[model samples]
Target: MTQVLGIVDIVWRGRNIPVEKGAKFRLGGIKNTAVTYGRKVGRAQEFQGSEVMATTELEAGQRWGNTWDPGEGELQVVCDTGQTFVMYDAFLEGDIPEITGGEGGKIELKWAASAPEEIGV
Candidate 1:
């Protein structure tokens, strides 16, 4: 079966926290960043099957190693899910970014894949 996936854009607002040596630290939101992409599969699915079919990652945004100085305020991120998230610690080097808001933070993600082309065998 063939299927088409629609592209999605996300937007949110929150705070950015800085961490040292993997230890959590508190920081108020003073930065602004954004991420955008297409539909993606959930990470939990990886355990469901031996061979992973669909996988996607985040791109076109700030990286983890790259230091961001939001500069005296708070930080917020807008995602495709339509839920605004306040970032606590941004792990840019990994496959995803860890964000927090209100009670706590969760991982935010985006993904995309090209439609396969058919060729006569």
Candidate 2:
């Protein structure tokens, strides 16, 4: 089964926009091996009963003005290699600068073979 390695929350700032919770979000891997966009995309590729390690969760809420703050929640996701990544409570809008603006964040993950013994098990 796939397992999650790490989760990092992200916040992208747009013209006249605030980083809020529950906003449309997407995630991709550094290896360019996996890429997910839109809610539909995320839902289509959610974790499948895998016991993966997650450090943080997705945030929730809405923007009222120029600023938005997404609280935090798990991003139900299964890595390309049967691993699941469920981010917990941190913002990760620094990985994808093109999408999340110049600021980037990341959610690190690894397969059972590549993961550290402390996390991969």
User: Clashes per prediction?
Assistant: 19, 40
- Candidate 1 structure lDDT: 0.28
Each candidate's lDDT (Cα)?
0.28, 0.29
Per-candidate TM-score against the hidden true structure: 0.17, 0.21
Model 2 gets an lDDT of: 0.29
Residue range 1-121, candidate 1, lDDT tens digits: 6433232222112323222122221223233434344664333211110110111232346453333233222223322334333333333332444454443333333222122122222
Q: Please, what are the lDDT tens digits per residue for candidate 2 over residues 1-121?
A: 7554333232223221222333222333223224567653332343322222222222245323322233323333333334434443323332322222233322232211111111121
The true-versus-predicted C-alpha distance at residue 117 of model 1, in Å, is 41
Worst 10 residues of 1 by lDDT: 45-54
Top candidate by TM-score: 2
